[model samples]
Target: MENKKANKLIDKILENLDKTGINTETLIDDIKELRTYALEEQIPLVVKVLRYTYEHIEENNSFLIPTLDDEPLDEEGDVIEEEADSPVESLKYLLSLIKNLKNKVNISDLKEYRDLLKAY
Candidate 1:
């Protein structure tokens, strides 16, 4: 079924995201494939997020820069900055956002996230 295919693709994407070195090209292709299913399922939020992720990786050769709040706070309450962008962390954050939207797509929250993503 369509859901089964979509779930399989999602699993594959999650696994790739967790890998030590991700192939950006492959990941982008996979995301594009998943977007088709999301479109068919009428999940506009997922579609939009996936499209953004695809475009971001294609253009930047890296994941989107996560929001500052997504950064960890050190004991001194300062943000723990990374010398370079962490694609894994950003991808995981994207997945978390998708998961949250899957349960219930809140219009206000969606707008907020859209703005946040656009700011990047």
Candidate 2:
């Protein structure tokens, strides 16, 4: 089945990165499992994470930024910490993660997440 929403999401991410000079190809590599995680949770993974982050902040000013430690090191082979010194830095890291999600996986695999995002 054609997944227009997934394609759109990919497009938006690409648009956002258009002039950032970020190495987008390396950002998105193996993401077949992100779809599975999204399906199982029945939520657009981004929305879910962001909501939890907002709620956590409202309930408590402190938070530990979510980690992708299970994933491999970044293109630079540098460790991405689960913590950031400030909210701006944390947001940047989260955006970077989203940008990286734009690769390798088929739209069919991303259908559920796309739908979740649409309904969101």
Candidate 3:
């Protein structure tokens, strides 16, 4: 049955996790990545087990799904929180912030630029 297959997938994931001593934070991040991969790969039960783990095991206090209350605040501390932002504006803001940071630190070398890129 479909339920048995789902349970087997969940068991396999747990067994794999048990074989390593990954820290909780890293494990959470890895699981999230796995969920995304499963969704992209069209694995139905893999997605279900991930959802269950995120909902019941993860300490995020809420399930993996975003709730209505998850929103961004405005200058006046109000949540306008549109569904998405313009990619161009996002990249511009990020570049401006990096430029300001680089100017503040006087970091012009390629190594420092790479480090800053990784930091953000």
Candidate number of the best TM-score: 1
lDDT tens digits, residues 1-120, model 2?
123444354454445445442333432321233333444545465545445443443444433343222444778998665533453343344444543445534233234333433343
* Candidate 3 Cα errors over 4 Å, as ranges: 1-22, 60-120
lDDT of 3 by residue, 1-120 (tens): 123443344344445444643235555555566566557767554455445544343554322222112377889999885765432232223222222222533223323423333333
Number of backbone-clashing residue pairs for each candidate, in the order shown = 0, 0, 0
The whole-model lDDT of each prediction reads 0.69, 0.40, 0.41
Error of 1 at 17 (Å): 1.9
Q: Which rank order by lDDT, best down to worst? A: 1, 3, 2
For model 1, where is the 10-residue window of minimal lDDT? 99-108
Q: Is candidate 1 or candidate 2 better by lDDT?
A: 1
TM-score of every prediction relative to native: 0.69, 0.31, 0.31
The predicted structure with the larger lDDT, 2 or 3, is: 3
Residues forming the 10-long window of minimal summed lDDT in candidate 3: 90-99
